[model samples]
Target: MTAEFWNGTMAAAAAAKQARVQVNAAYPITPQTHTVEYLSRFVNDGELDARLCKVESEHSALSACAGAAAVGARAFTASCSQGLALMSEVMYFTSGMRFPVVMAVANRTLSVPVNIWADHQDTLVNRDAGWIQIYTQTVQEIYDLILLAFRIAEHEDVCLPALVAYDGFILSHASEPVHPLDQAAVDAFLPPPGSADRPLLDPARPLQFGEVLFPDWYPDFELKKHRALADSLGTIRKAFEEFEAASGRRYAPVDAFATDGAEMVIVGLGSMMKTARHTAEKLREDGVRVGTAALRVFRPFPAEDLLEAVGGCRTVLVLDRDIGYGTGGMVYPDVTRILYHEDHRPDVLNFIVGTGGKDITPATIERCVELARGGYRGRVEFWPDARGAEEGVPYTEEPAAP
Candidate 1:
């Protein structure tokens, strides 16, 4: 059945409806707070057989997920912004220990003024934490990816954590149509959970999952995690295929729009991307020569696919919702890296926009494209937040004060 513009509150409730989740541990935060509220109602209504863990903080929420997952329970949790940052240190432990837990990150901007709004800073900030991160552009992806995340994360080849992310108020609260799936469909797609391969925990084995190890074997352990992540890419592709084969819904590592035979390309992530797309069509009709690429998979970086899309571009603009603090935008660094190793790399531009959920309209994207072709010669340009951004213009972060 199709979802009728259901809010994120009901979407979260849908999770309990679809998955056989055993424990849900979360601390309330804006935008995503309703997710927990709906999930709690599911637990109370007998629709879901789950233990509602009202933790004191986000740290405890994830900690519970790790513990429960280790002992073989379909654990779930959600958090954002400061909450994700607060659990930053322990995020290492959870993934390093290899627990098949899945989380829904309501992507939000980090704060100095402490604002709660949609942005990828929080999720991008934890990019190297060894989790399989996927961003869904639609509400149905949110519901489906959560279920798919469980299957992919728990696979023996990919014993890692996964984050099913979508922008906060943008995707979370915005009403959109989604195809809701039944519990039986989800079960068939996911298969029976054998994460630990037994009932709960068996004292007979008395295994030690987490322990301090010396440096000699640490490198080997770390290497294995690396291999698993790389291997999981194949498994990820497989899972997407399985989802499409069974559900008739498609997904990709990188979702592109009108990229065929274009001289220039624009890259976008999260909700701002939708705006860029609308402007791109107008630019294309005006014969300005442009294409737009959406980054569906951020963690894996989609290097091979990204290189193919922007391979022949004369100019590229990488729009980011958050600055990389000291650097310009995060995508600029990686884009430049992609070009450096290749024989042909385009003139890449970086603009940090929508830092605190500022409005990013089609006009903003149009202006950006215009400035990009202005014959500026530089690798980086720190746009004046969103309000002062200029397209095709060349500028870099000014030198630090002496």
Candidate 2:
């Protein structure tokens, strides 16, 4: 293993190369462009033996990857925000066809006002796209999860696409030390491309993909896909265990910090969770029983692990970077639902923060803890107010009550 100073985008690119991806078809987009650019450079320098298919648009990019996966080859791509929106149609096609293509998403805010920065809206909105979603907090997690994504996605029992999402500008641009596994180790961990059992588009033995099915049979296919995704949890955990053995780094679906016997806990995704964890430690110094739980695996939902993490707390404060509009934050409802059926449910609160690249500082987390402790009346509130704040307004001030 060699440790080097690398940004999240570079970490993703390095892992894809190590995985020996056969095809990369992606369009250039902000925050995510660096990943595809690095891959192109690798291919050009002969460092990675792969086909770099430059496409006209994000739609074409994912379509190209789907085609490559259809031929039973390992494929990769990177996109964010609008780029991800453009790939929405092909996203379902890739997953429904059971193609184990891997994609790196630099999570960014979607547009109306046109902003480019870190947020989870892009990936969260596409949560039901049938692709396995894994959110990363640090640059190292980006590298590690990308490699693991390929291994889990291609498992014989779970033939599904997977996405590794990291905060767009925060993790994507920030440089950090990452220990990249040696090529020999990576080769041993992941089988060669096309080794997994998948329906190959062979000339001698033809198979149909995206075939029209009557209503009677359609639900069965959907149910099968759902079951496959749910069963993938075992594959994911096994991959995590094997990777830790090989890399000496451990990962879990839900990462908890100082949650034992806590009265309150902060729950979130992406880079903000690191800050929340730090705030929790500081709060502990002040004799506050606060903890943090970061959701690593967003899709197979990890409902069981999440229940174990925050279920014991008296109050669970869910911090969301993406707003679900009428319903509040994207992740808030999910947390509430997970706890609603439990007999020991806590008082769950949702605070939508850091939307459109706004900063989610330690101060923001402190304020959230304060409000939760004070028994704030609203179930859902926006930090810094969704309505434009006056210039120089502090983030700690409570937003208009929900």
Best by lDDT: 2
Candidate 1 is scored at a TM of: 0.93
lDDT of 1 by residue, 196-251 (tens): 45334459777666778899898999899888876787888899899998789888
**Per-model TM against the reference:** 0.93, 0.96
What lDDT would each prediction earn against the true structure?
Answer: 0.78, 0.90
lDDT (0-100) at residue 343 of candidate 2? 97
